[model samples]
Target: MGLIKTVGLTKTYNGTNAVDGIDLSIKEGVCTALLGPNGAGKTTTLNMLTGLINATSGTISFDDRYMGDRRKYIGYLPQYPKFYGWMTGEEYIIFSGQLAGLTKKEALSRSDELLSLVGLSEDKKKRVSGYSGGMKQRLGIAQSLIHSPKLLILDEPVSALDPIGRREVLELMKTLKEKTSILFSTHVLHDAEEICEEIFIIKKGKLIIEGDLVELQRKYQKPTIYLNTEEPIEDWSTTIKQKEWLRHMDVKKNKITVTVEDMDMAREALLTDESLRKLKINSFEVAKTTLEDLFMEVTGK
Candidate 1:
């Protein structure tokens, strides 16, 4: 059995269902992503699972045991984690540890280990106000792990960062996954693809799809190619549609989108076209459908 499972897990607000009946299984030591668009009830589901709210109906089990103070085994980082700017990173983590029922000595010792684990040991004495956005997120992770929980949950952990900061945090998550189970929520598909082994995608508060990443893409993705020229080709859409290998084409202001009878053959043909040589081709690339593509298809976005 998986480490965590929910049967008919549901939550209702007034008369409406925020999260409908969901049967979920989260395996130990695997990273899971709860993916969904805006208003998808992802946050609400996490809240219920974390015991921040009451479930109107259903049950959640951890390690195949009926629920009983399961919160102690879970570490959560909300989408916006608030911290005291006046405290040093080290002080805050130790403080959190104490609040979680650790003795002062245990908290201090654990805080030291976690600070190193989250790459904050060097800056442990720095006040929270001096940290960068990425550094602060790392600190949040350190605090969450202070008690050595078995499952760690993060909500859109990197959604607010710039590209460089996002990459660094994602790398940190990769290392953390080796020691604890992780279930994070995000609308950004690439983040899930980069770190998670399994995906749980939801739409409108309901589960849409859940499976291995490679299997999901292989089963549902379409073959397509994209083309670019040095300059906008005059009447390019009409000419491109006339190709025998083309199934369909969507020409935008700068690029041409082509679905074809054969992805490899069409891409090669486009690249070798003698007519296009005179026009100075910039890029001719085949694009595989990604989790992002599947997300759009399932949600009709």
Candidate 2:
């Protein structure tokens, strides 16, 4: 029994299923990433999970330990979180706490603790409109956690930020995970790879793949060769595209990446090939598949 489990969870809009029958087991105290491309139903699934919308069918079951209103046990941050820009950071959190049913004293105490947790204690008095993009997001996180929910759900937590803001929110998430369970949706494969212990990948409103991050990487591992040459290898690449061991090949101006079924055979064949030897090779290296590769493969992108 994980922290939350869904059985044939689904949602339909005008007879079209935005989220098809999908089953998920989100573990307690672990960081999980819900991943997919645009219009792949990531948001719809999160909406259903957070109870923002009613599902057309299926069941969402929390662990037996958590009883009563599902909202009480879950905290959420939307992709585009809105805050009262006129309110100071501290005031906003305290307001959110009160909205979640805390007393004035309790909200005040929690606001102080959460302000420090998100690293905004010094700037807590500053209006949200004056804060940076990263600061706003950190504040949104604090507001979400004010009620002390067991699971935190964020929809595209870092998608709209600049590089610095993205890094800031990502670092905060890494720290927050140590204190509570997290489920976030993201299209950025690198960010998901950075923090998530488990991943669920969806495509076309369907659950395509779900598993432990390390285990999925190991399972999809493939032999690949990367080649950089002083000159373009376009002509030469086309000749070997039909090789028995070649699974896939991507050719750029002066670089070629080849995915192969057999590393031993690919190494021997490429090293000794007449056309390949003719080029002034800068570097040739063999490597394993990455999470990006897995995403590309599963999503057929």
Candidate 3:
């Protein structure tokens, strides 16, 4: 059985469906990235799965058991987690372990282990309020893992982090995937592209795309050819559009951008075109489509 599965999950607010029938399956030991723009229902879906909010309809199961029966087997790190400002990082983690049903001794030991795992062992005595955003996120991760859950749910895990902090958190998440199934939601396409094996894209409260990262890119990614020329062709835009194989073309400054369905054919045509050759083309290269491009194409903006 999958580590986590949701069937026809739905949530409604004031007669508007906020999360509409999202069906997802997360495999064990793999990282699944839930991607979408704001108000795409990513958070709402996570909320329902973590029991923060009840789903209006649908069923959720983890490790072959209903989520209600497997609550302890799941760990959740919410976006913008609120902790007691007075509690030290160690104390906060220990408290979480206790809530997960650990004995006092077990909680203390687990707290130490998790703090070290998140690179906060030296600052265990520091109050949570004194920690930076990145440190707090690390502490939140530690608290979530205290119970040793089989599945971890993280909402916008690196949304507010700077580049260095983002790199650290993403690396930590990658390491964690060895033992636990991770399902993280993020608006950052680059982060998803970097770490996710499988991805599900939500739009306007509905599941629109879901697949392995490579397959999705291969299927939807358009082939774009960029040309740098010294002299502009008088009717460059019109000439490129005359080619039926070219889907679209954009010319700006000394560069001509061409979108085509058949990359090989496009290359051949560009090589043979006398007008392009006469324009003193300085350089030409194919541009691979990125996750951001895919998202923009799918969402139509």
Candidate 4:
């Protein structure tokens, strides 16, 4: 059985369903991405999984046991993790460890190690108010992990950070996944692609897609050849449309995309045909459909 499983998980507010019946199974030691746009019930689902909020109906089971309280097995970091501005990063983490039932000495030892793990060692002694947004998020991760829980849940872990901060946190998450089972929600598809082994996409509170990345890409393969020109070739339309293998074509402002049934056959045809070589080719690429394409198709936004 999966380490975490939600059977017909549902949540409602004010007589309306925010999260409809959705089932999720998280494999042990795998990084799972919970992807959805704003108001897609990602937060509500996460809160229910962590036992922070009650589910109107359905069941959440951990290790085949439905623990009324899941805090003992879960470490959660919300989108915005509040900290005591007066407290140092070190003090806060130690305090968090203690609250999780660690002894004072154990908390001290764990706090120091966790600070280093999240790249907060340098700023551990400084008041949290003096830290940057990235530091705070990293500190939040450290605090959540204080108890060494079986599962880690993060909501929009990098969404609130600047580009640099985002990169830093994503890198940390990538490394942390090796040590713990991670389930993080993000609108950023690239983050999921970068770190997650499995993806669960939700749209309008319903699951739209759930699969391994490579398997999904291969299943929905759209082999396309993209050619860009520095200067527009007037006969571009006439040149490419003649090919029998062309399934369809999209002409943008600076580029032309040709979809085909066979990528290798199309690429060979484009390269060997001397008549089309006169065009000033700026960039060319042959690729399959991306996660973004699937996301746009499923989300429609």
- After superposition, the stretches of candidate 1 with alpha carbons farther than 4 Å from their true spots are 65-67, 227-286
In order, what lDDT does every prediction score? 0.85, 0.93, 0.87, 0.87
Please give the distance, in angstroms, between residue 194's alpha carbon in candidate 3 and its true position after superposition: 1.4
- Candidate 1, after superposition: displacement of residue 132 in Å? 1.4
TM-score of each: 0.83, 0.93, 0.89, 0.84
lDDT of 3 by residue, 84-187 (tens): 98999999998988888899999999999999999999999999999888888999999889878888999999998988779879989988988888999998
- Model 4, position 5: C-alpha lDDT score: 87
Clashes of each: 0, 0, 0, 0
Which lDDT tens digits does candidate 2 get at residues 203-241?
A: 978999999999988988888999999878999999997
The order of the candidates by lDDT, greatest first, is 2, 4, 3, 1
What is the TM-score of candidate 3?
Answer: 0.89
lDDT of 3 at 101: 88
**Candidate 1 lDDT tens digits, 1-301:** 8787888888999889989998888889899999998788888888888888888899988884535688878899988999999999999998999999999999899988998998889999999999988888989988888767888989889988888879879999999999999999998888999999999998878898999887887876668887787767556567667677888677776677777878767878777777766667788788765667568768775
Looking at model 4, residue 93 earns an lDDT score of: 94
Q: What is the C-alpha RMSD of each candidate to the true structure, in Å?
A: 3.7, 1.8, 2.5, 3.5
lDDT of 4 by residue, 1-301 (tens): 8878898899988888889998999988999999988899999999999998988998988884635556888999998788999999999998999899999999999999999999989889999999988889999999999988889999999999999899889999988999999999998888898889999999877888998877886787788888887766446657767678888787776688788887778899888766556666777898877778778768876
lDDT of 2 at 286: 94
